[model samples]
Target: MKIALLQMTSGIDPDVNAATLETAIADAAGQGAAMLFTPEMSGLLDSNGARAATQVTDEVHDRVLARVRAAAAREGVWVHLGSLAVEGDEGDPRWANRAFVIDADGEIAARYDKVHLFDVDLPTGESWRESSRYVPGQDTALVNTPVGKLGLSICYDMRFPALFQALSGAGATILSVPAAFTVPTGQAHWHTLLRARAIENACWLVAAAQTGTHEDGRSTYGHSLVVDPWGKVVLDMETTAGLAVCEIDPAAVDDVRSRVPVIAHRRAIPVPA
Candidate 1:
């Protein structure tokens, strides 16, 4: 299957972001992409938690999501919209860092919210407290696509290997980690961790990511990559807001699994007492 990954430097405006994304998706479809994936904060990158909390609305009322659904139907391709901040509650008004998969008919096939909150102080003196604005999801989601079973995750979730292992155990051949990683962390850990996950799970890895600078002067690492089952980077969009297209054959998954059989080689046992 031909898949396209979209990397964008999103800002705080929803309307402009949607228009830009539509153009990108159209370009990918024109190139014969059967499926298109966008990066995290595909709609808007609202840096101010307080302001974003007041602006973002419920998923049912989100104009951004509606536009994506319409675009998917119009293009006749599946769209994996990276992540959007949707309303969660009344008082706290949490954000759901969510990813949506829209089928060719524009119907939502699956929705996965980010389970892990990005609450940490970077060595660069940059602090991110995602929990203050977003309510973390409680479940791991794996969606069956025409290509294969795909595991969904966002940003910080990439750091946790156990999640990918679980997704692989649940029959996922492709793992998607849509991220807006900080420059510090991305430069240090991005390629290493992504490749490690692909090699360990013996699954294809696709990570569409935020690039350049946002409205808040925050720079994100933008090397969006697609790794094959054997942990080879088939396509790399390094630090530029563009699309990376590649073909991922499901048969390759079986080929690699049979060769290594790493999943079956494991003997489950308790940790050291």
Candidate 2:
């Protein structure tokens, strides 16, 4: 299947962001893309409370999600609407950071809320406390796509290898990681972490990313990539709002698993301090 990873620079306006998303999806569909993926915070990007203010609504009612659903139906393509800012329970209206799988009929197949909140201080004086603005999900989500079992995870979750191991153990053949990684952290650990996750899990890694700069002047590293089961980057996009397409044969998953067998070679012993 040909999958397209869309790298975009999202702003604070929902209408404008939706238009950009529509155009990008159309372009990818025009190129014969079977499934298209977008980045995190696909609708709006805000620094702090500004994001919290307007995130209070179901994504099914969100205008951007509506347009995305329409695009998927019109183009007869599957859309992985990466992560949208959603309102949660009574704690300052947290962001869900949700991902949706829209089928060809434009029906939502499954949704996954990001489990890990990005709460860290970067070395470049840029600090983010995602838990302060968003709620973390308690369940690990996996969706059966036309391709295979796709594991869903957002930006900060890439740092935790155990999540990928759990997904791989659950028969996930493809892993989707949508991120809005800060430029500093992305420059230091983005590519390496992604490759490491793919190598460790022996699954195809498809990551759509946020690129360039947002309205808040926060720069994101934009190297959207698709790593094969063998940990080779099949397609990569850098510093631009564009699409990276590649054909992923599901057979590669079995080949890699058989060669490595790391998942089954576990001794399950306690770690020595």
Instruction: Compose the digit string of candidate 1's lDDT tens values, residues 100-178.
Output: 9888888999999999999999888999998987899988989987667999999899989889999998899999999
Candidate 2 per-residue lDDT, tens place, 48-126, comes to: 5765476447765788899999989988889999988877655555667788899988899988889989888877888
Q: Candidates' TM-scores?
A: 0.96, 0.95
Compared with the true structure, model 2 gives a TM-score of 0.95
Clashing pairs in 1: none
- Lowest summed lDDT over 10 consecutive residues: which window, candidate 1? 46-55
List residue ranges in candidate 1 displaced over 4 A. 89-92
Candidate 1 lDDT score relative to the true structure? 0.88
Error of 2 at 237 (Å): 0.2
Can you give the lDDT of residue 72 in candidate 2?
90
